[model samples]
Target: MRNHTAINTFILLGLTDDPQLQILTFVFLFIAYLLSITGNMTIILLIFVDSHLKTAMYYFLQNFSFLEISYTSSCIPRYLYSLSTGDRTITYSACLSQLYFIYVFAITQFFLLTVMSYDRYVAICKPLHYVTIMNRRVCRRLVIGCWMVTLLLMLPLFILLLGLEFCNSNAIDHFGCDAHPLMKISCSDTWLLQQMVVICSVLIFILTLVCVVLSYVYIIRTILRFPSAQQRKKAFSTCSSHMIVLSISYGSCIFIYIKPSAKDDVATNKGIILLNTSICPMLNPFIYSLRNKQVKQAFTDLVTKLYSSQGTREILK
Candidate 1:
């Protein structure tokens, strides 16, 4: 066994350990990285520049863009670098920082989604009082609360990880320093950290899922009373996007960490990791854009304007 002090960097066993697949993996993830950045950045810019999008929906859209970018950026760059250079090694400090921020961004996303659900709930169920209920002050406070609370949640997890002694194991059997995969590297008995992770995971699951379920329940109950068919259709369309996003993200996260036992075998757990870190980010952009007509129009408008302006500039030149 290697000495505890000898462990300084970790060799990541990325998506596939097979060197033959590195180029293909790099190409695939690079495409995902491009789409995720471009789509989310466009959403953020749209929310910023579009005067019509100054409402609560767009405010939360901005937050989601920020979260998605931070979350995806935390891992994808490293994964892509590893794929391209065929260097999967990460220094101890770098890995620790990556792990910390991954959890931080994830926690932020959980609360942000919950806030979005509450926003939808108010907009739908309490339409008459929506403006007053979701006032500027209230919305700002809720957004701040989500960020602060997520930071708080990340503190204990980072401390717990720091205390662990990595005596021998240096291979992380995943693309990133995912909680479950990182835990496997601890040579010290990880019963306590695992338990802490389980409790934290459970809290996010229960808290966020309960909020979403309650919000949707209220929204649906109110929708049932809508007299107009168009109104009902609009309500369903609005909630469908949130429901799909919440389900997929939470589903992948739970599958990876909830069972605890399943996390031990990296080979089997690879699918779960892929969904949470890679697939979920990519899906968020397309899922949201495809389902929302306004966004589709906005995207088309952006593209058309771009090409039109280019042609004009060329003619003038």
Candidate 2:
């Protein structure tokens, strides 16, 4: 890995320059970040402690929650610190590290979502074989495979980024260190890097999207053939939370990366990135918990147990 870059630090031109707007943005982001951490952590805790959640579906949900926390943390805290301290300079190594983790977590999320869709497919379409197909060993392997694939895919691009020479400009237009923004400021011939990025992104996007679509196609077909209306509703309900999450995730990423005009719209891209990193992570736990009866039941039971334990301790005192 060659570090040929002359620039050691890059200045992030954050969301806004106005003091009032920065304050407002800071407050909003702080709240969102706090809620996102709390919510995703709660889900992880619930899955860990609740016996009722010891299933393949909940197993994947737990991993997904962890990813959400990691993904948001990878960039949001740095930006918050920058906003609060008026320190926008990030070291080159730190910026590259952030860029790597952000991509890893984000890309892994897409693969995980695709895995989740397959889990649902097996559960709904092949109910009799669901347990055998998505056993503990298989689920664990799937999660690990997602991480491995992401790392392998990102390694080349990251290596290329490491060799980039930034001579003219050090200003990143976005709040966080993103691939495109970094490339935008590089003095190196970025034609290869850009092509590699496009190829990797399109490959990941299309492959996962095709899997998700095929899974759902089979799932919908199976649901429709169910004889009873209640059965169809029940089947659809089980997958509803996953479907919603998939839509939000893929939709935001598509808008930002896949759209023909997205690269030219830097301001709009930043807005979308804020929403994707902060708001979406914050909303996911609520979406699942609200829609999932099993998770709700588990939460109620946990609360009741904790309350009872506290009361007993008071009586003993």
lDDT of each: 0.82, 0.94
TM-score of 1: 0.92
Per-candidate TM vs. native?
0.92, 0.97
lDDT of 2 by residue, 1-317 (tens): 32446789999998789999999989999999999999999899999999889999999999999999999999999999999999999999999999999999999999999999999999998899988999999999999999999999999999999889988899999899998888998888899999999999999999999999999999999999999999999999999999999999999989988887745587888989998999999999999999999999988998999999999999999
**Stretch of 10 with least lDDT, candidate 1:** 259-268
Considering every candidate listed, which one attains the maximal TM-score?
A: 2
Clashing pairs in 2: none
Cα error, candidate 1, residue 303 (Å):
3.3
Q: How close to the true structure is residue 273 of candidate 1, measured as C-alpha lDDT?
A: 68
lDDT of 1: 0.82
